[model samples]
Target: MEITTLASTWPAALTDPSGRRQLKPRTKGRTMVIDKGIGLHAFTDLLATSGEYIDIIKFGFGTSPLYPLPVLKNKIELAANQGITVIPGGTLLEAAVRLDMVPGFFRQVLALGFTGVEVSDGTINLSRGLRNDLIKDAKSLGLTVFTEYGKKLFGSRIDVDDFANTAEQDWSCGAELVTVEARESGKGVGLFDERGDCRDDDLSHIRSVIPNLSRVLWEAPLKEQQVSLIKTLGPDVHLGNIPVHDVITLESMRRGLRSDTFELQQVPFLEYMI
Candidate 1:
């Protein structure tokens, strides 16, 4: 007699949270975390439980310069081993620009093992020509390049035309995405009013020029900012400056698994692809 056996599978329990698809690596549905300083042990613990949910991990600011060489090397190796593209924060690069150490900085990065670089003038005056040149230099070093826009100030509101022009220039120079700066806080900055509400008119203005809107990553460090952007721009909008703990929560919000996007689930009914 022949017997058929079934594999045992447990359903998602009621005590657990909502359903959401974990994104694949190198996803445009990205969550870029700004790491100010996470020691080796804490970083390891973070990766152990949440590595799958993190896409890019940056060594925030020039804090990379302060870490013991061995510790930083180990951290970079660990993240890269798990296929996470590790890069130093753009502020660090801005510092390099300040010290005329761009080459030396990248030499250290390559020597220590980083797979990416961010080019931004958030804290400096990187003119259009120099910015493009910097992008080329980073690509020449075989780093995945991401550029950022907007100033890091309390009232640094975006002018849509300027943002669009800069974004196009950055893209033409080979940046993977242009990040809208929020500087670790979502309030009183780009796309956000004093209370952290998203500016609908600003988004509309940029979209009018940036045909490939998917390439713009909103730097949403707060929960409400992420929720608001997802609701307005759809689940596929790319977000940056996301805190490590909220990675899954951000993903849940994107996929309509959270209360914020529950209304988004009611799109115009369409036939299934199949």
Candidate 2:
């Protein structure tokens, strides 16, 4: 059967088991993939197979500067054509801020065709004024701004009050989303513990304070972290830092097609099994 027809033939009970949105330009359930230097062919393959499931693509760290100008622009243009927001990693932004090159950075990003910017202080300290300015600057340029909370330091944990305050400020400054930092390792930072376990209490507290959970994106690079966040926050929760190869796998878990979330299906079993 053709791929489009296969879903139609599935048991009615199995269709849309999780009732989550499946189309692109989705407001919630966003997935942000981290590109840690994949080649153009690999990148093209990723977009070909899984672009529909992606909402954003982050060029990990300062590597965006290292890519040949033409290659970087091509990648950004490809993602834009797929309706995916492309951004340089926050670390690069932090570097720009430190070097007093924020203006040049934004110009380069826009000229290169990136559609968004990640304003984060993961590796360095950014004053509230500076952070807000960065968000505003990006917004003034008609760029999507995604602000990140939490530090990248090992064993860094979330302070609920601080997070709440920062998130509010970020939104007021025109940030479209606020991401909680879990780094690429998905361990010992923000919501994850040293062993990469999701800190349930912290996550719960964050959800309680943040009225619109859809505006919050949790960086969950590990499979276990993804599973835990989805199970706790439901499938529509925004997750980021996903590896390229795992895009389909993550979408499967979100839609209840995978065993981890199979029970998320609304219908009871066996009746449709035969």
| Most accurate candidate by TM-score | 2
- Per-model TM-score on C-alpha atoms: 0.87, 0.93
What's model 2's lDDT at 260? 91
RMSD of each: 5.3, 2.9
lDDT of candidate 2 at residue 28, scale 0 to 100: 80
How many residue pairs clash per model?
Answer: 0, 0
lDDT of each: 0.82, 0.92
Off by over 4 Å in 1: 1-22, 263-274
lDDT of 2 by residue, 73-150 (tens): 999999999999999999999999999999899999989999999999988999899888899989999999999999
CA error at residue 125 for candidate 2, angstroms: 1.2
Q: Give the Cα error of residue 56 in candidate 1, in Å.
A: 1.0
